[model samples]
Target: MAVATAALGLAAVLPGPASADPGSEVRISRTAYGVPHILARDFDGLGRGYGYAFAQDNVCELADQVVTQRGERSRWFGPDGNDGEGVNLASDAYYTGQRRAGTVERLLAREAPLGPTPELRRMVQGYADGYNRYLRETGVAHLPDPRCKGKPWARPITALDLWSVIHDVNRVSGTRQLVPEIGDARPPGTDTATSVSRVPGPARSADFGSNGWALGRDATRGGNAMVLANPHLPWADGALRFYQVHLTIPGTLDVSGAGLYGTPLVLIGHNKDVAWTHTASDAEHGSMYALELAAGDPTSYVVDGRTERMGRRTVPVTVRGADGRLTTVERTLYTSRFGPVLSTGWTTKTAYTYRDANADNLRSMNTWLAMGRASNLDELRTAQDTSQGNPWTYTLAADTSGDTYFTDASAVPHLTDAQLERCTLPGGPAEPDALDGSTSACAWGSDPDALVPGLYGPSHQPELTRADYVANSNNGPRYTNRDAPLTGFPGTYDTGDRLGLRAELGLRMIAERRDGSDGLGAPGFTAGTLRATMFGNRVLSAETGRDDLVALCRAHPVLEATDGRATDVRRACAVLARWDTRADTDSRGAALWGTYYDHLMESRSPDETGQGRALADAVRDFAAEGLPVDTKLGTLQKWAGVPLPGCDGGKGCFNVLEASPESGTGTPTAGAFGSSFLMAVELTPDGPRARTLLTYGQSANPASPHYADQTRLFSRKRWVTERFTAAEIAADPHLEVKTLRG
Candidate 1:
């Protein structure tokens, strides 16, 4: 793999203000497997080192994110470019409107104490400068990645650009689903106020989200705390990718874990005394309001029985023309007191306005920094309380003291039950019903003694500290633990009641000993046991339902011979009946069963008739695709260009390896998304012992050896020991050292 050339002047020394530049103070050591261990004198130095190290590995990805955040994707990539779900034009329009509205600056100014502090501002500035320095020294010609080596989009970024990227990521998930609605504009009539409509929520997928587990002293072998952090995210997207790093500022800070590309702080990681991770929560972070528009003017709405004109801003979006020229497209965006007016395609008459708790909040990084600095569980809780930074996500943590904690730590809107009842549409609060916007009654934090504007304070969020164990598989706070589940919280806080298969399996694993005993007894959970369970490749569906399904298939006489397909289906049943219920790569019968399950889910058939039809459909589909009914799971779902075999456990399995049918033929399965990072941390008398495996690797540069090193390990159900201590770091034979000075 190519390393940054010496011609790039790695030792360049540029003098900045004395306070900002601590002269040759940032040192980065690349240990075995290309993980950077950064040692800095202070926060500013730390930021610069992190920025330089990360850029060395992912400059192209970082540059692409900056372009995407600036809403200039259309300008660089063309307006017709497909942005996953829609055209680049939609992304440009939405992001351009956000920038034109001065949302980031305004939010930064309004959010006091919770916003970026002077230290954070300096750190971000240092990060920007480091990134620019890399680009200046290693010109586009020296760029290792061919994807954006000489691309105009890979230009130098500024501090403001960094801030914009952060803000964009914070809200992009919720806004992406409303892109079409955001760009729609039409005239209003009397029917606009009376029409009933709802803004559709993003499709909920079991394939997404994460699995977090924290075992306390009582649940562990050595009477210590243990935690498993497995976050499921897209492996290909640069923005969502997690980079491993160990950052230290002497006595000020020392933490190790994973930070997303383009971010300055470790979003999920651990200090010597505490370890933490997050899973997407079931709480509603953003809401849509149905506005009562004026008879003639669609941009004016009725609020509190009075007419109010919607705020309008003309945003200029740059798009590349067919002739390779850049053109400016102007769009007029409308916003009501509730929030941005969104046009639901179902009806132009009713305009849905969107609002989220994290829309403009800038305290997320600071909150993470505080968490990293925490010395114990109490201090971690205090950090969460002080920043209230997380917009939406459930946080789970464990400490050296054998204390485990769980909380919906995001800033949620505090709406009383009475308010919800009065404002809720006929669809009820659980569904995506646009609340009546004519009165303040439906608006978030409208109560007389509301905690904050458009959000609930930390004191009001659901939190718990358990001495036994706590876990979540994105099923909400209701089922954090099956034995002593958190309850009594209002439905508005979390509408989900049932446990997902993954969550159920997690609880079961934690509650039982490795020897299959009922409870955590003499041989309880250790770091080894936790790691074993995390990669067990056991499918709950197969363990519980496969036998019955196979029996059902046998009982039903093989259908009349319609070609040889019927015989194949009977053979599949026999294979399934004899097969074990695990999803290891070598497991047989999984392909047949998985195909049938996918068809069953797609058909949404509940009755006996539906089951029969689904089975027949699966058989026909497999035969059409020319696949044998008894194909091995690995043969159908192996990784591309690699010998790494695939597994059968999917979506809601404890050892999740989610995949989807290949495009076009749709018989062979391709890995879609699953465990992006799998880490297990155990607090011991000596220190914290940790091991981790990134499904992909540290660098996005395909040519780099580190790009898929960890991925190969993950494919084989293996992990690399995290070199957290100085001794561990020193023992790495492949260590390379670099120093940075501003």
Candidate 2:
């Protein structure tokens, strides 16, 4: 990433003069597994150390992201290049449009409490300067990762660029989902090259799943608070990769845990008195509204007996052509008062627009930093109530006071029952009905308590304080605690009685251990026991369907396959009968049962022949890969040259390692997603005992010694003991220290 002006100073990148002082200093200590313990005097120095250390490890990825957030992907790369979100052209146009609208600029212009405080701004500036310092010292050509070495797109980044990255994450569940649609939207009959109408609405819920458990003293064997954070995110090397670090400012700040690649906050982890984690929530953060367009004028819509003209912004993207020449392509994007107009569900007679609850949410980092500084669960809840900045996740936390708390206080559209009943139109996406965009009567309500308008206040969202436990596995808050079901929230919040397979399995795991039925020889959980159970790799689908499937195969010695041929099921039935119902590495027939379950889910019907064919196909797939049908999972599924112990499909595996084909082959050689970072934290009286493991290692650069160290430990189901205190930091034999002055 090349900066257009190499001489742009750090002061220019910062918003104000209240950034890091001229002689700001920071110290970074690297413990085992190359985890950095950064000590500074204040937030600015802390962010400086963090940003410098993070760049030392992940400069390539961060630099590429700077280009991405700047809407220069089409310029630096090509128009068709994809950065895992959408095509380059669409991403460029979407962000360029936002820049033109001055959205982020207006956000920064707000007053302190609602916008960014001075401390936050200073920290952001310090981070930007720290990253730039690293870049200046190392020189772009000498960067470790050759991919971005000497690349023009890998230039020094600004604090505003970092802010854009933060905003992108806050809107991941909302506006980010409509990048292609917003970029390609056009007036009807004006463009013949439009393909936006064929685009799909937001997806990716299943891609982000997790099991978060917050256990109080009543559920703990040691009478202490325990939290288990098993977030199942993508294993691919990108923005979502969790970087473990311990940030400290003596008495002012002390926290240990992980944050995403390009940010300066610790998103999930533990402080001295509390431990917290997040699970992706099923609540809706945005709504798609149907616009009543005027006849023969797609750009004009009628609202409450009045004609309203849609807002128009023409965004031009500069693309690097195949011949290395730059050319400009322009598109006219439309918007209503509700929000940006989407190409999906748009026609000459009607159009669709979307409104995101988190569009202006800039305080999420404030909440996270507050959570890190919180001394107890009440403080945690207070931080939540005040910031209400959770983007789209449920907060499950446990404090040393033996209290467990759970809340879906994430940003959500504030729609009342009356408004829902009065403004519903059939066939909406995500929601049961598209909101009536024609009138202000259907608009989202506001509360004086809410920091943002058109969003539910923190008090209105689901929340609970329990002594036993609170757990969520990417499900609604209704069943956070099975014994005490929460209800009466609006449909937008996803209140319901039903639990998904993963949710049911997660709840059952807690109950069985609490009742001493899980063969763990205990009635309550200990940090050690919780860690063991997380890696237990129990496959619920196999336990429920394996026997029945085997019996069916036995009853029919031979069955018809999907190819209209006979498949012998006797061998499959025998193998399943003798197989252990777990997704462990050595479990025979686990792969076959996984295939059968996938077929059942897809067919959504009892197709006996299809099951037989699925089993047969599994066998054939193994044979094609030159392995036996009963081969150990460890022998087949390997990532980073280490055998991944968990199962491939979701398949009800609590310890999940979802896998995908290698170069389109049927054999899965790598984990594409699932179980990225696992942590078990216990707030013991002896100052917070915790263990964590990042499935992938610390650095994306394979040349780094830390690249696969933790990954190998994860393969063996091991963890790195967190070093939070100064003594623990000094105790590591592999400790290396460096200090920076600016």
Candidate 3:
């Protein structure tokens, strides 16, 4: 791959409208497992091929997302009244406010020095054109999926729609939660603002997160870098859908990995010389401000001792009636100097406003694009430092030079310690309502004219590099590496003092191997070692807490019997006593222990002592649900629509699998959110060798063969070989070729 110093200038030569014919220059070849290998002459052609391939697999999903982003869901498919369209009146109101805010238009116009650059602009345009072309070629009657074949929302999409989707993604984590408050600011009988008194804590939910690992030469058997990218995202919804593709612009770009729908760049993946992944970071990306409302007018607030009226905008929201007619309802939205004015419904005298780090950011794609083009770990770091577009994810990268890096690349609010101390109210800064906004002291101190104000410059963020290894399981930057701990960073960035079980497990795995006389007697990792560790079903809780639980059970074996529940409890103890600490499909005793552990964590009983009450409850619940005490873990925890044996372990386990309870049995064992996309890349002397598996398969269309192919493979702990090079792609016997054009 050739390194271009002025890589951003490559977009300047992108074919003009007359010469930029998609079908003439873009060739998409479907390799094994339905992965598209796109060969394009330039960035525009690459985008065209990407849009066509994505539409082929997820047209309906894409269409639905477009509809949601356009804020016309209610107009097209009635209010979210249990119609299965997944859009509600609140959604309509929120999206309408977003559109009326001019988020897309403003960002596009301002993104320049830090940019959705010319290259990105051309690529997005080409992608929109290609998506439209797909819709034109495959009429509604010929649509692949019958579920949304004739739906009016599945019509052609525009470039603006794509831009809006991107904007929505950036704001989803920040202001999306205030939709109801924005819609119901001045409800009848409510004259006060809502109280945002509760402070945000470290997210402990098992619903969404990721585990990323990078191994340098010192920790690897081949003296090469290795990376494991396991992002735990939703399996079904289009929200976190990750589409895999290999894009090549000859000498300009050659990168392959997974990205979400509607994005034109690969968010996580590897190029020839560098491989990278991301995990949610514990950084504050937004701030809440308490405004002192002026007397006699609720919508006017005092700033710098001057009464400033909040800007008011009425968004017309259209909702479809039961009879299919549309009715337009007007929703009043107010914005203060701080940002959107949220109706907190608090009786207190103060109003609240929220400002997000990426509120007007449109340069995230450009950053990812630059990272993809990087030739080394240093280059990747430079790309991140230059384009601070990443909103809230820590980046982990490994290069062929045997270097490993980890950084809180998320754009965080640059708040100084003095500012926080001076402006903090009685409550701590963690409390949403703690910031005193009457004066500019509590304000995010950034130049008002800057494109994205209050964001930390690259020098302010925390980063670490280790020749041995680096890993993060969504914990703060302080524990990126246990031995070489990142210290002295401000507490305002991350206040969590302890590491989660998953992070502990990841560190332990690396430390044990590094200390032991392993492969080549140097704690070196091989491809096989990494793969085994990822699939290893050892549950951390079982390993650490099982012996004590069994001892406690043996001591107080007898509980009050209710419908033979006492006998079931003894049986569960016996099963757990003889169980091996593993979460594989056929592991016995896993189900009982998993249930017991879950209840132990969730039990709110004040009368029960220690784990006894939780254990008894787990036994009683298991018996009541008609499941045997010694049921195999696989039988109780199955994936959707699959009859195969289930895997064990909950969130924080090395083999992480968090799930909801099965309807029939009250055991929380069914798979919900886990590692949907797993990619392991190893940098070699020849090039980069990769393997990946998507647990839910590639396409959302049920009729497609690729829909469940990888899911079956995932069930058996298997991975499909990632063909990166031209020769490797050509060697796939099942390859199918197509040429898409204008």
Indicate which candidate wins on TM-score.
2
Per-residue lDDT of candidate 2, residues 167-211 (tens digit): 888887778767888887776676544564454443323347788
Ranking by TM-score: 2, 1, 3
Per-prediction TM-score: 0.90, 0.93, 0.90
Better of 1 and 2 by TM-score: 2
Question: After superposing candidate 2, which stretches have Cα over 4 Å from the reference?
Answer: 1-23, 82-86, 196-199, 202-207, 428-433, 607-627, 648-650, 663-671
| Per-residue lDDT of 401 in model 2 | 90
Superposed Cα deviation of residue 149, candidate 2 (Å): 0.7
Residue ranges of candidate 3 with Cα displaced over 4 Å = 1-23, 81-87, 187-207, 346-348, 421-434, 447-451, 516-522, 560-568, 604-608, 643-651, 665-671
- Which runs of model 1 end up more than 4 angstroms from their true locations? 1-23, 84-86, 110-112, 184-199, 202-207, 346-348, 426-432, 446-451, 518-522, 557-568, 638-640, 643-651, 661-671
Q: In angstroms, how far off is 634's CA in candidate 3?
A: 3.2
Model 2 quality (TM-score):
0.93
RMSD per model, one decimal: 5.7, 5.8, 4.8
lDDT of 1 at 488: 71
